[model samples]
Target: MDLPALPKPITVDLSRAALIVVDMQNDFCAEGGWLHSIGVDLSPLASAIEALETLVPAVRSAEVPIIWLNWGNRPDQANIPPGLARVYDPDGRGEGIGATMANGSKVLTKGSWGAELISALTAAPNDLHVDKYRMSGFWDTALDSILRNLRVDTLFLSGINSDQCVYSTLTDAASLGYDVVLVDGASATTSPQYCHEATLYNTRQCYGFSTTARDLQTAVSAYPDTCKERS
Candidate 1:
């Protein structure tokens, strides 16, 4: 795969890089999930899931840590405040804390299948999982601590809702002085096409570089040493 060159060269150290996948949960991707029950389209997520199915293993082959950043609220929903609730349901559809969707999965509530990662994606034994209450994984989460402890400085971000959760996390990572790359085609948006394009534009112009998963896979495969594969 021919890699897309950035405007300028951006050096990414494989040893210190991490790949983070955001919000690829049943609630967001599966047909019977909460979002689907609420009339949100799950079609866009298919490509992202497909890319990760292959690209994640390529990343592991390169010895880069794969972190799953997902929305998994507490069962009590105590961390969710009025603002977040309103954003989730502006029309007041009674989809607040503890409210179950038509599919019987409570949105964002922990211990619910809806909050779990979609069945198609599995976590490797060495992979990391971080539950987030907000759009940015760093907000009220141990994401930063985990990255710091692992000495990770470069991040490749891909997943659902490119305009929201993905962008939010990318921005936060860049602000924290981490090198961020938004893996294009490995992310999706239920919103209009413009929303996805806008995210790529903004992320590239303001936050980080953007490239496809194929490009990333090629880059990872070029690493000089044979990194230890995860068991």
Candidate 2:
């Protein structure tokens, strides 16, 4: 199928395509979660949820795989480097990853409420789930192996912190030779507006093309009749 995207329109084979939703988890997106508990405004990240609501089902209906890549750190956090640990708790406060939030959930720890996907989004039983420790999901995660097993060559990226985790994963996917598409509406960031714009610009200029959720939906809707035939 031909997807209308920035930098140019590109054709994608549904059989070799998958959708990766990154860090749409509660820690980064929900109120009372990690970022919110630390006083970061969540309004910017919330925009991606609405877009994902429509885009997810549309992509699923077309038989495309939905891969949820979220932060699910070890409880001990032994694998976390000092530099990364300082990102969340620069002053040696106890309010970093693995810290308990006001709601009684440990921030981003595996099996913690804060590490789970937002309640608004549902993961289908057969969908893929990957736990990531770093901004780049490819590092120390099974994401790349799973994509390879599925024989996916094209990835549709969406999720929170467009300038950070989402961008990091996209960059790695491109470096690994996978065709990537950043779904603008389905991805957002808590960073400044300029940061988000820079991410989009960099994606189109260096990494891969980008398209709106609506355009992606339109493209997927055009291919329903061929879903079973493709994969």
Candidate 3:
């Protein structure tokens, strides 16, 4: 199927493609979550949820696999390096990853509410889930292995913090030789407008193509009969 994307339209085999949603978990998108507890605005991330609500079902209908990649850290924080830890808690405060929130959920810890997907998004039973410790989902995660097992060569990327996690994962996907497409509406960042703009610019210029969720939905809808069952 040919997808309408910026810089140029690209062709993709639906059976060999998958959608990767990064960092759309509670700690990033939900109110009273980690980023919210840090006083970051939650409004910008809402657009991503809104877009995914429609796009996810559409892509699923097209028989494309859905992979939810989220930050699910170990409770012990043993694997977390000091540099990464400092980025979150510069003062060595207890508010960073693994810290218990007011509601009693440990921030971004595995099996914690903060690391789970937000209530608004529903992950199907057969969909894949990967726990990532770093901004790039491919870093020290089973994401690459799962994609290989799925026989997916093309990846459609979405989710929160477009300028950070989303971009990081997208670039790594490219480096790993996967065809990448950044679904614009389905991804967003809490950073300034310029950061989001630069992400789009760099994605088109350096990493991969960029397109709206609506365009991808349309592309999938157009070739409904052409989609084959996933392996």
Q: TM-score of every model?
A: 0.93, 0.97, 0.96
Error of 1 at 188 (Å): 0.9
Listed per model in order, the count of residue pairs whose N, CA or C atoms clash below 3 Å is 0, 0, 0
Global local distance difference test of model 2: 0.91
Residue-wise lDDT of candidate 2 within 1-231, one digit each (tens)? 888899999988988999999998888888889998899988986678998988898899888999999999999999998778766688979888788888899989999999999989999998999999999999999999999999999999999889999999999999999999999989998889899899999999999999999999999988858454655
Better of 1 and 2 by TM-score: 2
Residue-level lDDT of model 1, residues 1-231, one tens digit each, is 134635445667677889999998888899887667778877887888999888988888788999999988887778888778765578877865457877677887887878888878888999999999988999999999999998898899999899999999999999999988899889989999899999988887888788888889888877667444332
Consecutive 10-residue window with the lowest summed lDDT within model 1: 1-10
Ranking by lDDT: 2, 3, 1
Worst 10 residues of 3 by lDDT: 222-231
Model 3: how far residue 162 lies from native, Å: 0.7
Off by over 4 Å in 1: 1-5, 226-231
Which candidate do you rate higher for TM-score, 1 or 3?
Answer: 3
Q: Using alpha carbons, what is the TM-score of model 2?
A: 0.97
